[model samples]
Target: ELKAHSEFRFESNTSLQLVLKRGTAEIFGTELAIDIPYNFNGVKLAVYTYHGAALEITGETIVEYTSEETPMPIYYNLHLALEQRRMLKKSPRILLIGSGRNTASKILANYAVRMGRSPLYIDLDVTNGSTLFPGTMNAFVLDKVVNVEEGCPSSTPLSYFYGQTSISTNMRLYKKIIAKMATVLYKKLEQDEALMDAGMIIIAPKWSDSVGFEILQHIIEAYQVTVVAVLGNERLYSEIIKKNKNEGVEVLKVPKSGGVIDRDVIYRRQEMSRQINRYFYKVDNEFTPYSLILNYKDVSVKKISEEFVAPTSALPIGATRIVDDIRVVDVEPSSAMNHMILALSACEQTEDEEAIAISNVFGYMCVTEIDDAKQRMTLLVPCYGKLPKPYILVGNMKWIDHQ
Candidate 1:
C-alpha cells in the first residue's frame, strides 16, 4: 500500500519485473494492468500513481525509492487543456521543447494515448531517439498502446537517417531533413484523415543557441504547430511567446517532474548501445537477425560529400555532385567500414541524391568486419535472406555489438 499522488522511481541496469498487485498505477500515462509482470532492462523509469496502490518488484536495481514530490497534477491540467484544444481543432501539432524533453514527451504521449487518441511521436532528439536508434530522426504513430516492457513500438517507423547523433555534425542537413519530414507528413496527413486528426507530439533536438529558436520558428511554420509547451524553462517560454506572438500559438510553461533523472554522455552512449542491440535482437530475443557477407561489387557504399551548398543538377553523371548540402559519393571498402551502421535507403538509384536524402530508410545494417584485400564486408541485418535495396549510406554512426 502506498500514498496517493506519489511516484515510485528506479534505475535498473539489468532485467527487472514490476507488477501492480493491488489498486491502479501507470508508467507515464499508460495504465498498468493489475497482477501483470512487466519486464524491463537497462531502463530508468517512474511508476506513478494518483491513488494508493501496492506494487511488487523482482530483480536487481541500481536505485529505487518513492517520492512525494511530483508535478503530475500540473501535467494533467496541461493534458486536459490540450485535450480540449484537440477536440476543437482538426489537428493540433504539439511540440515539447526543453532540456528535459524525453521524460516530458513520454508523459504527454501516454496522456494522449489513454484518451483514445492516436498521436504521432516525432523524435528529433537524435542523441537519444525513442522510435528508432539514436542518431535517426523518426516518427511513430502510436495507434496502439505499447507493452510496458517494449516502451515504444519499433515494427515500422517513419525514420530518416541523419548519419550522426548530434545535429551539430551537419546542421544544414539537419534543417533539410526537417523540411523533408514536413513535406512528407503533409502528404501523409492529406491521405490519412485519422492521422491528421490525431495530430503530432514532437520532441525537438537539444538546442541552446540562437539557431535553436530559428529552427523552432521554421518547424512552427512548416508543421503549423498549435501548441508549444516549454518544460522547466520560464525564459524559453517567454522567448517563444514573444517570437510567435503574431502567430496565434498557445505557449505553456510546465514544471519538469522532480523524479526525472539527468542522463550524462556515458549513460546516453550505453543506452544507445542497448538501443542498437535491441534493434537486432529485440527486447526478448524475439527476432534472430541473420549475418550476411558481401563482396565490394555486391552493393554500393555511399557517403555524403564534405562540401555543402545549394542543390545543383548540372554536375557530370556518375560523379558526386552537390545537392542540398549533401551529395552521395561512392566510398571504397576499407577498415573504416568496420562497426559502422549503414542506412539501407529505399531509393534504389544511387545517383538520385535528392531522392536518397528525403527517402525514408528501408532498414539499417551494421558492418561487423571488413577484409580490405578481399574487398568483402560482413553485415548483421534484420533481413533473413535478401536485402531489398542495393543502396547503403554510411555516416558517422557506429555501434560495436557487445555480443
Candidate 2:
C-alpha cells in the first residue's frame, strides 16, 4: 500500500519491469500500463503514484518511496484550448519549444491524441527526431490516441532527410529545408480543408530557444504559429511574451513535467543509432537490408563544416565562412566516412552545389567498411538499387554497430 504523495523509484540494474496492480501513476507525463509488465530503466527518475497504489514487479529490483508534487494537470489546459478551437471551427497551429528531457512535444502529442484531434505533428528537432530518427525532418497526422507504452509510429506521410543531427551544424541548409517544408505544408493546407481546419503542431528544438528571440521569431513566422507555449523556464516565457507582444500571436507559459530528465550527449547519440537500426531492421519482422560496394570515385561527397575565411590580418572580416552563413565544404577524404550515415543526393550528379543543397535525399546509407587500398566503400541501404544519384552528402552523424 502507498500513501498520499508517494512515488516508487526504480533502480537501474538487471532489467526491471513494473506491473501496476492497482493505482494511478505516470512516467515522463505519460500514464503507466495497468497489468502489462513494463521493462523500465528508470535511472535517476521516479514513478510518482498519485494517492496510493499496489505494484507487482518481476526480477531483482529496488523501489523507494519518494513523493514530490508534479505539474501535469495544468498542461491539460493546452489540449483543452485546442479542443475548444476545434469546436469553434478554427484551426489553431500550436508550437511547443523547450529543451530536451522535458519531452515538450511528446507530452503535448499524447494530449492531442487523447483529445481526439488529428493534428498535423511536425518535428523540427532534427537532433533526436523524437518520434522518428535523427537526421530527418518529419510530420504526421494523428487520428487516434497514441499508446503511452508503445509510443508513436516511425513511418509518416511527410519526411525529408537532412542527414545531420543538429541544425547548428549547418544553419543555412537547415533554414533551406525548413523553407521547403513550409512551402509544401502551405500547399497541403490549401488542398485539404479538414486538415487545414485541424491545423499544424510543431515541436521546435531547444537550441532554437537558446539561440535568442530572433530564432524564435523566425520559427513563429515560418510556421505561421498561432499559439506559442513555453515550458520549464519563466524567463524564456517572459522574453517571448515581450518579443511577441501585439504580434497577433498568443503565448502561454507551461510548467515542465516532473518526469522530464535531461539526457547526456552520449545517451542521445545511442538513441539515434538505435533509430537507424530500427529503420533498417523492423522490431516485429525478419528483414535484411541490401548491401552494396561502391567506388569512392563514383560519388561526390560534401561534408558540411566551417572554414576560416579571414586570416589574422583580416580580423574584422570574421574568422570562418560560416560567419557568412556558408553551409558545406568539399571534402575529399572519402574513406573517413566509414560508419557515418550518408544521404544520397537527388541530383543526377554532385557537381551543382545548389541542387545538392536544396534537393531531397533519395535515401540513407550507413557505411560499413572503407578500403583505401581498393578505393571503395561498403554501404548498407534500406533497399537494393535505390541509391539514385552518385552524389552522397555526409554529415556529423555517426553510428555504433551492434553486430
Candidate 3:
C-alpha cells in the first residue's frame, strides 16, 4: 500500500479511494489520517509517503504517472511564517487578492487550519458562493481542520447579506458594506483573543482586470492589511506593490493551481441557488423552510439605488446622497424582484442610506410567490413563521428553483 517517497496521483476520469493503512503520508501538505478513506475525483492532488507505509486503494480509477510540480509547498511555507508570527504574538492580517476562480484562498485557509491557527476566514466573493453562500459576506474562525469534501458548515460561519453577486453592479454600496464588515470583524477580534492574535484571512472579491487594481487598493486600506497575497497575476503584483505606500505591508505573489478551471455564469448561478437552498434545507431534504405571507406595506422593499433625486439634477448647498455619481441598478421589489432573494435588515425603515448599507441581516428569504393583486408576497424563510425584522432589502438577484 505504501512505499518510501512514493507518490499516487489520480486522473480526471477516475475516483480515488485511499485509506492510510501504515506509517505516514501527506496530501497537499496535510497529513492523511490513519484508516481514513478519502475519496477524490477530477482534482489535481497527490498522496506522498516518506520512509514507506500504506494499506488500501480500492477504486475504479486511473493513476496518472506524470511528474508535475506544484507550488503547494511554497504556500505551506507562507502558512508557517504566519503561524510563527502568531506564536510570537504579532498579529498579522492577510488578504488574498486575485481576479478569478484560480485564486487558491480556500486551499490556503485550509492549510492555515492544518497548521493549527484559528484564523478568521472572511469570504468576499459573493458571486460563486464558495465559502458560505452566494450574495453573502461570511466570517468563520478556523479552530479545527476543515473538511475536503464539503464547504464550511452553515453553523460554523456568521454570514451577512450583501444581497447581490457582483461588486461592479453597486460599487458605492459594496465599498460601504466591506468597510462595515471590517469594522464588525475588528470588534469580533477584540472579544476573541485567539482569533484576534491569529488575525484575519480574507478571500478577496473576484475583481475585473480593469477596475480590480483600484478596488484592491481600497480593500488594503480598509482592512489595514499586513500582507497582500497576490495569486498568479504579475501585473497585479507589481501594481499592488507600487500602490501600497503603507509601511510593514508585504506584497507576495503566490502561484495559481493549474487544475483551477473557470466557471461560466450559468454554472455560478446554479451553484448560488444550491448554496441558498442548502442554508435553509440540508442536503438530506429533512428540513423545511417556513412559508410566510406578508403584506407589502409592512416591509420596506426599496432598492438601494432608488434615487429620490437624480444625480445630474441640482441639489441643495449641503445635501448629498450615497448614489451620487455611483452606478446602481435599482430593483423594483413589487415587479422585478419576483423569485429573487431578499435580505431581512436589522436597520429600521427610517434609517439613513449608510445605516441600511451596514446593517446586519437576520436571514434570507426567496420571494417565492408575489401577488400584486392582494399586495402580499410569500417568502421562503429559514425559520418557522418568525420574522426577526420588518425591513427587507431586495437586489437584482434571482433564483430559479429547478425543484
TM-score of each: 0.92, 0.81, 0.81
Winner by lDDT: 1
Q: Give model 2 RMSD, 1 decimal.
A: 4.2
Better of 1 and 3 by TM-score: 1
Worst 10 residues of 1 by lDDT: 305-314
Please rank every candidate by lDDT, starting with the best. Answer: 1, 3, 2
Candidate 3 residue runs with Cα over 4 Å from true position: 1-67, 99-103, 153-156, 306-335
Q: What is the lDDT of residue 188 in candidate 2?
A: 84
Query: Which stretch of 10 consecutive residues in model 3 shows the poorest summed lDDT?
Result: 323-332
lDDT of 3 by residue, 1-403 (tens): 5557665655444555668888987664457788988775434455656666665766665445422455555666788888888888788888887643223555566677776677887787777657767778877787765555334433456666776777776666677777888888888888988887787788888868766777777778888889988887898789778878878889998876544446677656556766666667755455787789988777667456622335645666677644463322334347556788888877766546667666877777888888888988888887886676666777667875544
Best model per TM-score: 1
Look at candidate 3 and tell me the lDDT of residue 176: 75
Candidate 1 TM-score over all chains jointly: 0.92
User: For candidate 1, lDDT tens digit of each residue in 276-302?
Assistant: 888998888888888899898898887
- Itemize residue pairs with steric clashes in candidate 3: none
